[model samples]
Target: MLDFAIFAVTFVIILVGAVLYLYPCSRRASGIPGPNPADETDGNLQDIVNKGSLHEFLVGLHQEFGPVASFWFGGRPVVSLGSVETLRQHINPNRTTDSFETMLKSLLGYQSGMGGGAIETMMRKRMYESAIDTSLKKNFPLILKLVEEVVAKWESFPEGQHTPLCAHMLGLAMKTVTQLVLGLRFHDDAKVLGFRKNHDAIWSEIGKGFLDGSLEKSSSRKSQYETALSDMEAQLLSVVQEMRTQQESGTFIDSLLQSNLTERQIMEDSMVFTLAGCVITANLCIWAVHFLSTSELVQEKLYQELDQVLGSDPITLEKIPQLRYCQQVLSETVRTAKLTPLAARLQEVEGKVDQHVIPKETLVIYAMGVILQDANTWKAPYRFDPDRFEEEAAQKSFSLLGFSGKQACPELRFAYTVASILLAALVPRLRLRRLEGQVMEVKSALVATPKDDAWVRVVRRS
Candidate 1:
């Protein structure tokens, strides 16, 4: 038995050696600098996984190496770009697909395909625009109604008591997005809570499954993920069935049903939007609140603007223009929090940047967090200053990579609108104060979140 075990291990090692000899794991460019080959453990993925934080690790790599550095993600050669110019060169002309979608495909065990021809892309774009219009114009009141519910809950909370802001924000986001995007209304709190539970499960699994093989490795987790997907699909299908029976028009899901796409395709698209819409928007609100709490001056100024613009009335689409200071605050929060820290693309053909060659099929990552804080572009990059965004003149000095940019995710516009509405509702009603001496730790997750509870004492404004 011992001899057989030795022979088996020797055979496996030899097989791996032969595979490496025949086809090298990574491509190397002569001028590119990266960690030595010896640093890569367990087929080039260990360095990334073993690092404490992927975002900080990549930032460190860019600081050590130059703008364009080479690394590997699980045997795939990856070149990471850490400058605005470098990223612009690559992403501007090639904004057809987003990194999240690519990551989604991989997580769902699908081949890396960005899904959409020219006509399809046009249709999808139109659909997105229409959805945004309906959401902002026709559905604005509904969203405000949801926000008011959140406000009422907060108002009822004991004074000077800390609340887990993310949970409340996530609950609000999930309901608002689902209602607006899917036209699915929750009649009771229990139903909304049920949907959110499944959403949390699938979302958590997707984040874990991207870098680790946990979904496939752990049978219980794999079953949970599958069950969540199945449950979500059933819920979506029920919505479709109800829409058909009721003959609803001008709904995003209804539009999908009208299209010549399979039920499976519709479900896939809706699920992606629902998951991303809920989580990213939740994180956005959480970070916005955190930043506002940390900067009392900004919060005061924002309140002044809100008071001046809307007066006692609720925020509307028409009034959004006059809320420039609030916009600046949110923009600064996005920049400082560095939400969606990484964007990725695949090199279709050979490319070159500054005497370095990028071979075909190489995975490229745009490190947005590091670039957003580039000292050369912004003054005191680490400081959170809403005034920094007051002028378009100042913005031109640095790239204002907002929710919609060349490399920005498309759903970001929808998420931004939702976040703006939530902020508009809350800033006027409550004052958020962070617990003293609590450190604000930005954690790297599917979306960046606070390392701790992100508790804030909510006080109703007199």
Candidate 2:
């Protein structure tokens, strides 16, 4: 039996060695993996695909291999392009066949059957829009009005000292997006209690399934998400019914109704708007405050921009455009924080990438976080320097992160509007300071979250 075991081990070792030997090594590039760009895989590479956590592995592999490297993920061809220009061309393919939906379909397991959700379709279209839609446009004041309620709560909290101002970012984001879309504030001493309960029950555990293969693996998790989504749908639909009865003379809902959109489309689109807006805004606010507090000089500079542009007046969407430095600060905040919140895709027939001829069906992905931080493109790639974006060229360089230029999301034109108003509202009334003894970094997930709670204390300016 011992002799048989020894022979079995020897046979396995030899087979593995033979497989590795057959695999091509760096061919085209100087420091990359795979054979030359000429070498193409003749067969499906499932081993590379199913390895899972495929992103982390590919990042490490790319670091060794250099730009334009290829790897396998889920029996599909995956290529990593580190340069910004090349990346821009990769995602904006001239076809509707490739998009965030392909990725969502993968995540939601949206196969041919099961009947897809309207919310998903609405989310995709909104994401594709270059700027805020005509419907959401009317809700400009409502967005800030909702946030003012959240800011009021923070003001009510005890004066001075350390506070978990961190958690409030999410709640603020939730309230702003919720009210903007549904015209309802869902957080308060009473409602916050419920929001927290529902939030924890649903979202807290949603990320855990990301580890063990599919998000569908946990029945409890699947149910929690479904329940949360369904509850949201019900809440929005009820609001729609109420709005229909009142028939507001002028409002976001009124505009939504006037459009030839279906009832189901309204609910789905609003939810999509909520998801799209809430998550990014909250994190940006927290990160901006955290970074600003850490540098008094930078804070002072931002204050100068704020006070000089529209002194003692509430920030309006019209005024936000002229605040260039403040805009730069916000842009720098996004760049430095590297939220890389989501990945984008396009179905370009894959050309030859390293050892593999990217088959037409293979999905192509770009790591926004890593791509944004490329040392070749960014000086002091890891440093937090707002001035880098102060110049036109430097600022233009960041268009890959969706600020301006060809791939720019039109919503970004207004994100500045929202971010500017929020910052202006607080800068005059509060002083933000980062907490001590905490490691500040980013949490890697579907979106980048501040790794630590990112706590700060706010002192109301007298």
For lDDT, the strongest prediction is 1
Residue-wise lDDT of candidate 2 within 189-269, one digit each (tens)? 466445445544434433344433345776877788778656766776877777778755333444566555566656655
Tens digits of per-residue lDDT for model 1, 49-158: 45555567688889999898876543445677887667655633344445565455444543312355746655654554455455446677788898889888988999
Error of 2 at 314 (Å): 0.9
Q: Which stretches of candidate 1 lie over 4 Å from their true place?
A: 1-31, 39-43, 109-116, 209-214, 393-408
lDDT of 2: 0.55
Report every candidate's CA lDDT.
Answer: 0.66, 0.55
What global local distance difference test value does model 1 have?
Answer: 0.66
TM-score on alpha carbons, each prediction: 0.86, 0.76
Q: Which pairs of residues have clashing backbones in candidate 2?
A: 25-34, 27-36, 28-36, 31-65, 32-65, 49-74, 130-410, 131-410, 188-192
Scanning candidate 2 in windows of ten residues, the lowest lDDT window is 1-10
Residue 271's lDDT in candidate 1: 70
Clash numbers, per candidate? 0, 9
